[model samples]
Target chain A: MDVKAEIIAILKDVTGLDDVGSDPAENLFADGVLDSMATVEVLVAMQDKFGIQVPVSEFDRNQWNTVNKMVDRVGELEEA
Target chain B: MHNITPYSSPTYFIYLLLLLSPIMIGLYNGKRFRVYETFATVIILITAFFGGNMSQGISLICYILFEMVLVLSYLRYRTKENSKNNFWVFFWSVILAIIPLVFVKIDPLLNNATISLFAFMGISYLTFKSVEMIMEIRDGAIKEVKPWEFIRFLLFFPTITSGPIDRFRRFQKDVLKVPSREEYVALLKTGTNRLMLGLLYKFIIGYIFGTLLLPKVSVLALSYQHQAPLGLSWWVLAYMYVYSMYLFFDFAGYSLFAVAISNFLGVKTPMNFNKPFKSHNIKDFWNRWHMTLSFWFRDFIYMRLMFFMMKKKLVKNRVTMANLGYLTLFLIMGFWHGETWFYIVYGLFHAGAMITNDAWLRFKKRHKKSIPSNKFTECFAIFLTFNVVCFSFLIFSGFLNTLWFS
Candidate 1:
């Protein structure tokens, strides 16, 4: 599966919202795509899918803040 | 006999100062007079020595440590903005909060159910605040802190006893601002109003209703003269509903008082209740009643556990089987309430009620569109859901003994 697609699917499931309309660059938490705990849920779900252990430190408010940033994080971890 | 009443406070003078000093700190923060905010917290904590119990002392210490850990880490990583520290903080903070709860709270409740000498004045609030702070810190949302800032943050005594569960970022901004005399006086009146209303709820509503109406209803139910009256069950059940509302009013009223008191002293406290009796359904009720406490459970327990279950495919058959996913969520809720069977049952009962309510709503929305919306239908559902919640409280009352299966 494409990593971005996988990420998007996980976000969808975690939120239980079928259509989240935020831009990929918009912060998931602040933009309300994911709430505080849902953010953790999505992070954990991403890790399970890709078999990567994203640390809690990766939950920074910015940088890995949006979908695209979170995708980049997955890429960094998978490559590592 | 020398008379004593609610107006009397053994620690009134010190608490007054403890409450007042925060104003100066808020004043200083507003004046840009202080370099660090945590110092105010330390001074207030020094004042907290006059508090009633050891549990309170431990809670005070732990809250500050957890706050410091998060604040220091946030300050360290705020600029560089990598998430490794954020990850560690969240991971560690969750563990830090849960370990104490498991060992100190749950274990004892299961074993002896002793309400410890320390029953910790504000354990519930502190746990929520500490965990939320760690998450906020990891997000780099908190910009600055000094020791005094932390004291003001944690030990602002009004919200210390009962809480509106103020969010840190929102609370921090409010703490930094100074209230004018008018605003301050208005806050005092508001606090007084809440406090007075709370007394009415607690003494008049929760207390009098508990004694006069609730127990009488219970006794009648238990001691059937010839046969258990069919209507007697409804009476006991109805009064239970009223008592439960009174209980929330009592607690939420106290929370509002604390919020108002904090506001009067120039601190912002969030609104805790939204007319819970008006909640039409279980989810809505939880969202309305003891709201901060419920939200704490949602953010800390439910969402994380649900995510984990979904990841493992444990919840895959959940809707179909009604077996695992939501049950686990409820069990967590139960355990979060305490270690007794009552709490567990209470948790599961709520889960079952809420799921049923949700399914029913979806069915109604889908099928009953043709039926005109009526106050009767709306009020009937609210009536039913209220009865369900009150019935669940009965399970909690016996939580320690009969929670498992009885």
Candidate 2:
């Protein structure tokens, strides 16, 4: 699966908000697609599926708030 | 020379209004006279501490210095190049921040024999702020930490006692910027209106319900405690509504005063209540009532619990996980209120209501065509929610325990 697609799917599934109009750069949090709860779900799902452990303590919503940013983060973490 | 809690009395408002004039003037003239603001804040804080309670004042000072060292050190650790952020460090920072509050809440449970020396007014709110800062620092959301700015945010007098808890970044934005003349004028108008409305709610309506009516209703209800039907009667119902009203008016009125004061100083603090009685369900009620505190819980507790459960794969079913989350969140909230069976039950009651409400919502969503949807139904939902919430308040009031046990 495409990383971006997977990221978007995880967010929608976690939040139960279908048809979230996703621009890769669009902010999920700011747009009300992902709240703090949904963000947790997304983070956990990412770890489970992608094996990327984004520490909650080090999670910056601003930097990882968009699908593209999240994808990039996963890519970077996976590489590391 | 009685030291009263902030905005507790009309005289406190008089003193506050007088003290705020220069700050208001400075903001209106496009100048944030930082020095004057600092001096005024000190005076008010001193009044809160020494005017009535010297012990609390000393406690407050100790609490501030302790939190300052912890936060500053945490910030430093976070910024270090190879610091390999340890979870224990973050955990301890948070634990230390709330240690004072933990003792304070537990003090009442120790047979009321020993008081927690760390107890002080606004300790819970301060702890909330400190914990948030630590989390932000760990997240690298707060890149730099200045001691004075951190202190200013912690000591921001408006909403200090009871907060519509402001976030550090959100508050920093307001603190660093001067509102335009037009904006400042609007803030003044809104602030004054809020202040007047708060006065009406707290002093007028709250006084009528809490002072004049509550005692009478309580006596009436107590007198009829054994009237059957589970220690309930018409008077108990009346007590429920009266107590709920008193709670709402008193807290909402206090919130308005806090927001108004923040606005007067050109800072727009968030609101705490949003017509909570109009909620259609228990979940909706939580969203509307004590909004900041609930949101804080949602962000810090519920969400985190959800993630932890899912990561550990502790609960297989999502619905069950959500239910557990609500239970955990409210139970903690209940315990936070005090170490009492009544408080715990009150928390469980809401958790049960919310879980049921969510199930109902899911059912309704699936059966939208069959389920009746109309103005009458909507009205009925509001009425049902209001009554249920009132009953919960009755439980929360501990009147049942008093009637049955005491």
Candidate 1, superposed: residue stretches over 4 Å from native: A1-80, B1-59, B70-89, B107-119, B143-147, B180-189, B211-239, B300-329, B399-406
Off by over 4 Å in 2: A1-39, A42-80, B111-115
Q: Given candidate 2, what's the lDDT at residue A3?
A: 89
lDDT of 1 by residue, B41-117 (tens): 34444445434444556755765675566555555665464546645656865676545555556547465765343
Against the hidden reference, what TM-scores do the models get?
0.67, 0.89
lDDT of each: 0.61, 0.86
Per-residue lDDT, model 2, residue B172, is: 95
Which 10-residue span in candidate 1 chain B carries the lowest summed lDDT? Answer: B1-10
Tell me the deviation in Å of residue B236 in model 2: 0.5
lDDT of 2 by residue, B1-406 (tens): 7666899987888889899899899999999999999999999888888776488888888889989999999999999998777989988888988888888998876785555767778898988888888887887778887999989999999988889798888899999999999999999999999999999999999999999999999999888877867778789889999999999999999999999999999999989999999997787788789998997888667876787788778999888988889899999899888888899999999999988987887777567689998999999999999998999998899999988888
- Which 10 successive residues of model 2 chain A have the least lDDT summed? A29-38
